[model samples]
Target: MSIERDHRRAAIVALLLTALLSLPLSGSVLAAGQATPATTAPSPTPDPAAEALDRAIAYLIEQQADDGGFVGFEGVSDPGTTTDAILALKAAGIRGVATESLISSAIGYLEDAAGEYASSGPGQAAKVTLAAVAAGKDPTQFAGIDLIALATAPVATPAAGTPAALVGPGVYGDDLYDHALVLLALAAAGEPAPAEAIDALRATQAE
Candidate 1:
């Protein structure tokens, strides 16, 4: 029984790693040679990365509970996991009225739990912020110490003695991944991002 359990754990870990890795590859820009404009401005081809994200999102939708939230592998509709899935679809350019409605419902679920969420935890708030940003919605609905921190902070590279990330910054167990989400959200919103954030992202660009 223990061996079977161990194997199950390993498999779950593998799936998570694959999902996290696959998440970032879903927003590649078209190559210069392939950047021709549409004929009469016709609709563009479906991006391969977007197609991949659609499959992932389809799987997630299939697994959603009757309550309209996904049941995490661990249990419950964890805000963190849902946030990641939301951001992935958004990054893949899945922004439509239907998508927005679905995201709004999920936000309701997270809101119900926000009281217990750490007041000033950057990590937790980041997930919600990213999802809201992706949906092109204002984040005024979510206000807390963490949210305040974001509004007030210099948005600069962390000063000396500062950590690369704070505990609870959305993509748990992976500092770099969380940082990537923050950078992605800022870019999508046309927000003025810090040079260090840009530099850090450049460092992670895949060849």
Candidate 2:
């Protein structure tokens, strides 16, 4: 299957797990005016959602490479794909023995790729920031670059009737995806997003 298909499946699995986890446990609540004796509640049946999530986790674990990264497009091991897998597993509450080693390896790969990611582009920087935050690393110190700053850097626009270009603070691309991802990364890093960036993104949306 394609990487995009895999991503969609992973998202579905995470959402299923989230929904399953939100369900109330099988138990009885006592009323304000209690009866003579409380009745025993039936044992909870096995949850199909939990079972599916376990299978998904196992599949993800099997896909993990020796170097700790997951396969992306064209079967290439990529940090972004690894990050997505890690976040998906996390969302499903699949940790401990089932995912500990996988998570550790992926984190190591991301840390090692920090420099390359920082030099790539704003999108890459945003993705790295998200991954770093997910792995409990500080984005400001990752690969010796402030990923948040790199992602939020403003692009230079040519000024009319002037030789000098004007540079302003905003998302690097000022496009929807770049702005949205950067904002997400900033939120994940516990940093406050700039109001101007939010406004800029909002203005670009189709009415």
Best by lDDT: 2
All models, RMSD in angstroms: 27.4, 22.9
For each candidate in turn, the TM-score is 0.49, 0.67
Residue pairs in clash, model 1: 123-168, 123-169, 123-170, 124-168
> Candidate 2 at 175: error in angstroms?
2.4
Off by over 4 Å in 2: 1-43, 94-98, 156-169
> Can you write out model 2's per-residue Cα lDDT over 1-207, one digit (the tens) per residue?
699999999999999778756776544423425553756899999989778888888788777887888888868678778878878765665334355556668878877876786656666788888877766788998867888888767645423432111124654543456567888888998889877777666666667
Candidates' C-alpha lDDT: 0.56, 0.72
Highest TM-score: which candidate? 2
